[model samples]
Target: MKKLLFAALAVFAFSFSNAQDEGGSATSQGTWLIEANTGNAMVGSTAFTFTSQDGESVYNLGLDGGYFISDDLAVRVGLGFGGDSAADTNIFSYRLGAKYYLGGEFPIGVDLTGASIKDAQENPLWLGLQGGYAWFITDHIAIEPGLRYNLSLNEDFTDEGVFQFNIGFTLFL
Candidate 1:
């Protein structure tokens, strides 16, 4: 997973550098993005070993709106729903970040996110940080890959730490 994330970052880096050399604009400013992600969530501790969930895929359908603060910088916010087999979680994720446009038409950004996931039984909130890169293959389509590290704040699950690797396509409208 780390290797794949690095490779994706390399590709995005190359594309972004090339695009910048050719002079790209903030045309994608105010653009709306819809994305989906699938990955696993691990829960365990040294004292108590919890059974790991298999094929624990999470589907995130989100809408992001971007506002360009500068040619190479933007602020974005997204809201989405995340769910797995055992629970359906509703998440409100807020990111305050900036984007740096790479040469071709691609962009990379890092975000500090606070997310709250609620289910019928418990509500767990997490504070996480993520870095992502988007490779724009076309004006309307892009491939996005990201890495997230989250620490749970719930007392019962305080020891649980999650690392997620995600790759998905984003459609701009």
Candidate 2:
């Protein structure tokens, strides 16, 4: 998983950096954005997990994409797969959301996320809220650092909410 993460980052770094083109605004209407997003890359959270856990080794891989329906407002969708090594469980995750870019830099978003754990009957769902700043490295790429909160909606699955710090790589087109 670590190797895969490193490889993905390398690909993004090389491809995004090399594909730079002059652009107008990243948040304009009809623009599309694709992101490689990870939570707790530097600090906060135990794993890239949406459910509550106590020090379990976990790894997640996900992609998010959005299309601007209007200037500064985008509708997005995401899909992810992860696992808990301790529990020997594989999890499938999904997210649906909207993000509004403030002045095409600061972004605030709300999302619905859920994870289905293998061999478990209960699927945990969460309401996720995040705020971040997009620091554009080029006209078409940005590195986003953010704070996120995942509020667990199902107490029977997970009673506690998750707070995560995230670093994201985005390609704007």
Candidate 3:
């Protein structure tokens, strides 16, 4: 986990060297992108928990790939796993969704995803919504900080929702 985080930071840092405007922003049409998030994942009280090596609870990391169908609309899919954490409920997740970028220089986006995780203990079915904004470091890249609210739709779990904070960068091509 630490190594991956370091490598991601290294890449982001080094990407600034000799980078010119790639002319792609969140609101740009027909653009493809890849992104990653490695920050705090705050599990809510009603959330299923994973215990780290230090016996602390945390959520997994996420990676996503997306394409802008139009200047304001994009479709994406993502995966979340490998926190080096152990839990009664192991959640290796897969999610598919779309985001619509609101009007701005660096647009704020609203997203809705249907998420499913592999839970060894029970049925693993869920969905999530996220609200975020992009702060462009370069025309081709941005640092995004976002909040997510996820709820378990399965009957075995409570109806309460979980919130997580994510920080990551997007690379446009």
**Candidate with maximal TM-score:** 2
Candidate 2 clashing pairs? Answer: none
List TM-scores for all candidates, in order.
Answer: 0.51, 0.82, 0.69
Please name the candidate that would achieve the greatest lDDT relative to the true structure: 2
* lDDT tens per residue, model 2, 101-148: 999999999988887778997888888899999998877778889998
CA lDDT of every candidate:
0.50, 0.77, 0.59
Using lDDT, rank the candidates from best to worst. Answer: 2, 3, 1
Model 1: what TM-score?
0.51
State which candidate, 2 or 3, has the greater TM-score.
2
Which tens-of-lDDT digit does each residue in 3-66 have in candidate 1? 6754664564445433322333333455434443444433211010112357555444444556
Task: Report how far off residue 127 is in candidate 3 (Å).
Answer: 2.4
Model 2 TM-score on a 0 to 1 scale: 0.82
Q: Give RMSD (Å) of candidate 3 vs. truth.
A: 4.8
- Where does candidate 1 have its weakest 10-residue lDDT segment? 43-52
